[model samples]
Target: MVVKPDWLRVKAPQWERVGNVKDILRDLGLNTVCEEASCPNIGECFNAGTATFLIMGPACTRACPYCDIDFEKKPQALDPTEPSRLAEAVRRMKLNHVVITSVNRDDLADGGASQFVRCIEETRAVSPHTTIEVLIPDLCGNWEALEIILRSQPEVLNHNTETVPRLYRRTRPQGNYDRTLELLKRCREFAPWVYTKSGIMAGLGETDAEIRQVMQDLRGVDCDILTIGQYLQPSQKHLQVNDFVTPEQFAAWQAFGEEIGFLQVVSSPLTRSSYHAEQVRELMKLYPRQRV
Candidate 1:
């Protein structure tokens, strides 16, 4: 087992505020990607009253070895009430920005695109001012399904590249690297107004060169935002950590991403896709794009 470096260690969060956020999520029966994916920043995000809401599941359709979310159990039926409850959570939390993500529901015909539309609409109904971002699956390359969600017009549409193309088969066996890039490219083509975002997890054996290439690929598709974070093994059964990237390297990637024209790049050891995601509200003000 590889030992974690001191820089990767997380600061303990204030339990009082953390508990308050948990209380609201439980009361409304909502799930968050922060908790489900075992994100190291859960405490800090919860303490600050922000969470990336995981809709359609705590269960996923694909069994990616690196992920902490469950895929063994039978997936549940879509909960029609989930969107309203999620909106209520936003209303109660008074979030200025909200992120809605989901497990890959491949069993559904549209890969749960309709559910995403409902969530966006419901959230808007309750909190019109809240900027919405959706971290979505590739919808099995179903561009039509993607269009359904894109039509809802969330402020940001995020899909993770997860790892470099060379690692896709081992790390994300079911995910297609070309298709992942195509999804982001199509998002820009279909909805020019929405900011396109993608993330990559470093330290799963990808070299610094490969990482930079992925950034270039994303930028080639006009991706507006990029986040590169270190990968942590969820458990012994999951994929083992190959390396722990240092803080300086993360800083270098941040600098490189910005130089390549990414409007925002959040890179660090503990930076998950949605870490400090609310900051995008300010990004919008600085580089606002009108709906096309």
Candidate 2:
């Protein structure tokens, strides 16, 4: 039986002009993970004047049991002008840091790698000093495709492990735990200057030992940043929450991540991978001599 976690109270103030912003996104035919994934921190992020853009397309190629994104055999064609439009949005928002992510576009030849590069270039062209980060797919373990994005020189490259290896068959059937580790390892190898990052969700029936093992695997890959957050079930159709990890448990994990040598660790009940991204970018800037 799955243990139901206590629903934490979230009473973020509504963004007054959020609907206008949503309309703009809809008008441009763009998708945001914040909307699609039902992120609880959407109001806070939008109110603070930043949003993570989901590029390529919203429909995913793989159906992870924990996700609510639609899995369609064939998705819409890539938007050639998306890069420019995203740049325009960033400029309009006056954003100094941006996070670009995408659905698993396994059908594309370059795995939509080139588009990722284009978005970075366009963002930089319009906002030269803006720090950019990308939460990329594993590309089905395609190193060449990953290399394409790394070459674009984003400040941070993040991909999520999502859950423990034992749960892969149930949580992310299409994903491979070992392959994900290899991907993170290669990111560090390809772009030594770029800060490599990954995330994992707790309260998925994973034992404490299992979580520790996942952290060790990440460390083996030289993952510089780590994020641990409670996994809330997206919907009834998705995986049921096994437990609701408490705030204290999250704090313990944060301390453990630091003890394991992660340069930065963000673990909290309300933490998502992209939470406080602006602050993360600012911290990156402080370590100028360090890798990007």
Candidate 3:
């Protein structure tokens, strides 16, 4: 029998308002990771007035087993005007913080780096005071592409390790563990003034030691913010959950992360990488800037 954790049973506020948000996005003909990946926190995030914009296209070139994104043989053309449209959406939402991520476009020479830059420029043009966070891919470990994005200067540059290194083959077959570390390390190197962030999913058979090691690896890259959350299986084809991490365990991880010098750590059963991202930015503002 599959065990259901009590924490997952707690009632959350209704997110019917998200329907209105969805209508707005739909009328605009835009896609969101919250909707594409079927994120469990969509209701909470949307209800709280935040959303992670998905750009480039809905089809991802690389197929990660742990992810629920569709793999298209021939992905659609990049929208030249998506940045402005996204900026307009951000303006309409009146979001103080915005997170923009994209499907991996390995088909492009720059790996969608230019598109990221456009999104940043457009978002800043519209919402100058909004803090922008981007959850990015490894850019196929290309420093040039990564540099392009850093030059755009988002407030937070997040690239998820997703899971422990040992499960790379099963969880993210096309992804490289060391490459991801290099990506984060290079982000800090290229944009010393920008805050770096990364996240990992627990209950994917990652042990305490392994998770700790991942944290150390992230720190080695000079990552300033960290998020740890439980992995929920999106479909039968996706990776199954080995266990559901308890709220107390999540708290312990959060405390451990802070003790190890992470500026901010959000660890919980429902915590997603972009969850409470604005609050993370606010927390960082209280600290002394670290020399990159």
lDDT tens digits, residue span 34-80, model 3: 98988888888777767889998799999887778888557888999
Model 1: residues with Cα > 4 Å off, grouped in runs: none
For candidate 1, write residues 82-199 as lDDT tens digits.
9999999999999999999999999999999999999999999999999999999999999999999999999999999999999999999999999999999999999999998999
Error of 2 at 98 (Å): 0.5
**Best candidate, lDDT:** 1
lDDT, candidate 2, 1-292, per-residue tens: 4554455667765657676667667776777888888888888777777788999777889889888777854687988899999998888878888999999998988888999999999999999988999999989888999999998899889999989999999999889999999999998888888888899999889988898899989999999888888888888888888888888888888889889988888998878889887776656766553544
Candidate 2 off by > 4 Å? 1-7, 290-292
Q: In order, what lDDT does every prediction score?
A: 0.95, 0.86, 0.86
State candidate 2's TM-score: 0.94
Q: Which pairs of residues collide in candidate 1?
A: none
Two-way TM-score contest, 1 vs 3, winner: 1
Which residue window of length 10 is worst by lDDT in model 1? 1-10
Spell out the clash pairs found in candidate 3.
none
- Checking candidate 2 for backbone clashes, the offending pairs are 193-292
